[model samples]
Target: MIGVLVTFAQTGKFDRSTLAKIAGELRGPFEGMAGLRFKSFMLDEEGGQARNFYAWDDEEKARSFFTAELVEKVTGIYGAPPTIEYLDIVGFVDNSGT
Candidate 1:
């Protein structure tokens, strides 16, 4: 399993509703993706940051989704480049029914 973490500094002009909508727009299309096990997101208002946890079968599968179009779309909304961290998950517990 692979994990992708993204942290962003919010512009502060956007409200909670807008943030939720943006997150939905970004993640909704990934629902049917193959080799992608799951995704979980966290947003911190105090820190003005966001994190996304992605579980995939391999690194190649993860890269395939970070295409030019996706990058453009994301940068257009977020304004600044996000710091992404990729990791190999050794173990986990999921009550979400994997």
Candidate 2:
């Protein structure tokens, strides 16, 4: 699997509600994306940081979401640029109870 990780800095004005809005927008589109396996997000409010990890079936499928337009859509609200890292996911663990 291909993994895309993004580190974000939120706008000073963002509260929990603003974070929820950004999460909703990302989830809405990526959930329907072709070849997308799963996506998970994390936030450190005290540190003013957010991160998302997405697993995709292939590089192309992953790159589709890394475009400038999409980045703008998400980071624009924060008024900052996000740092992204793309890596090949060679292993994983899923412990969610069914």
Candidate 3:
């Protein structure tokens, strides 16, 4: 599995409520997405950052999804460009019973 960490530095450009609302509106499209194991939208208001963490069953699919176009689009959404990092997922636990 692969983990993708996408971070946006808000720097007072966005508030928690706005980021939450954006996450709510955008999450639906990720539901049932191919090669996606899990996705999380997170906020750190005190740190002025927003992050999206994704676990992918296929690294290629994950890489393809985060294209330059997508970066530009997300920049427009978050009011700043994001820093994306891909990591090797060495351990995972799922207790949700889905």
On lDDT, the leading prediction is: 3
Q: Tens digit of lDDT per residue, candidate 3, span 23-55?
A: 889999999999999899988777788989999
Candidate-wise lDDT, in order? 0.74, 0.78, 0.91
Best by TM-score: 3
Clashes of 3: 0
TM per candidate: 0.80, 0.78, 0.93
Q: For model 1, what is the alpha-carbon lDDT of residue 95? A: 89
Which runs of model 2 end up more than 4 angstroms from their true locations? 10-15
Model 1 alpha-carbon miss at residue 18, Å: 1.9
List the candidate numbers ranked by lDDT, top first: 3, 2, 1
Candidate 2's residue-wise lDDT over 17-84, tens digit each? 76677778767766677898888877767878877788888988888778999788767765677888
Q: Give every collision pair in model 1.
A: none
The order of the candidates by TM-score, greatest first, is: 3, 1, 2
> What RMSD value applies to candidate 1?
2.3
Poorest stretch of ten by lDDT in candidate 1:
6-15
lDDT (Cα, 0-100) at 63 in candidate 1? 77
